[model samples]
Target: MGFREYRGSRQHTHAHFVLTGHTSFEDEPPLLEELGINFDHITQKTMTVLNPTKETDASILGDGDLAGPLVFCLMFGSCLLLGGKVHFGYIYGIGGIGCVSLWCLLNMMSLTGVSVWTVASILGYCLLPMVFLSGASIILSLQGVLGQILATLSVGWCSLSASKLFVSALAMHDQQLLVAYPCALLYGVFALLTIF
Candidate 1:
């Protein structure tokens, strides 16, 4: 029978039928997968951030992701908030401006230029140390000698991690120091934010 004839015959049957294997039926992914938070990816990035001298896998760091960065930035802001410093706006604002500035600077300095998002991701991932420093400030006043030392170390950690990633991703082996100087300056700003 023709489709039209079958439909006409079923007109008196007001019920609707849907096939389980219909084209419209789709299996949704699990919540974790849908959220795009790859634990493995974040773990690798975090490890690299912790160990600044370690060589990063280009394929991993080159694939820019903002999830870890967003978490670190938020953590830094939250820790600062807990420490009685409400600098969420400064955190995000400095982060955005710093990422753009680094993106521009690195592009000019490297043969294989990078995108702003990639720069942002790398910088954001490196912010983990700063986040920790911010968290520490909650229990200890950062205006003293010990606090200054910790803040300096954290800034170095962030700068080294970010510079290493940027250099490896962009193949700027000869210009590591050049890349690191700006990274240090940027992270120094973040350190200043964490301190005062």
Candidate 2:
């Protein structure tokens, strides 16, 4: 995806939800038959650290080759620069996401079955909700304790939104919370920082 500065009227956005959904599937999700990721199950399986699926044809992390995470970085930076309501360093907006993303991508391997690419891609795709929440927090001009509270709540939303897919992609169950815990902390820190 290319990034273009909008000269037109900007109402702001859900292509994000669709795009994120694109990252979740190994092959063209039924909804996106025309222009969607064609996750190659055969190639992807060879790349994963673990495959809990009995079916070898299942879509794993490397199945799809779209660069959703890279697009997200640009979106985040752009939102911070454009949103205007966030009254802090632009680095805070952009860099906070990077930091949280890095932490999750790195620590996610502690679980039994996960791939670095999948973790990064999932977190990258997951950036949609986090960025939107931050944008909303800034756009609404939330601050002080109330701001912190709302920011933290947004983190919860990201965690919940991401958990289902993360669990599925990693083929984890029963102990999914173990995987989710790190995400909670990363979100907690970044979400609170948005208030400051």
lDDT of candidate 1 over 96-174, digit per residue (tens): 9999999999989888879898899999999999999998999998999998999889988888888899888998887
Instruction: Give each model's whole-structure lDDT.
Output: 0.87, 0.54
Residue 160, model 2: Cα distance from true site in angstroms? 1.9
Alpha-carbon RMSD, each predicted model: 7.7, 15.2
Index of the highest-TM-score prediction = 1
lDDT of 2 at 130: 57
Best by lDDT: 1
Model 1 compared with the native: what TM-score? Answer: 0.84
Model 2 lDDT, residue 143, Cα: 68
| Model 1 spans with C-alpha error above 4 angstroms | 1-36
Tens digits of per-residue lDDT, candidate 2, 1-196, equal: 9998878785424786566565445654475445445444323432231222333333544334335555655665566556553434543454456545644554564355454556656555555655665677546766666666677666766565455446665555664576566666666655654554
TM-score, each model?
A: 0.84, 0.53
Error of 2 at 84 (Å): 5.3
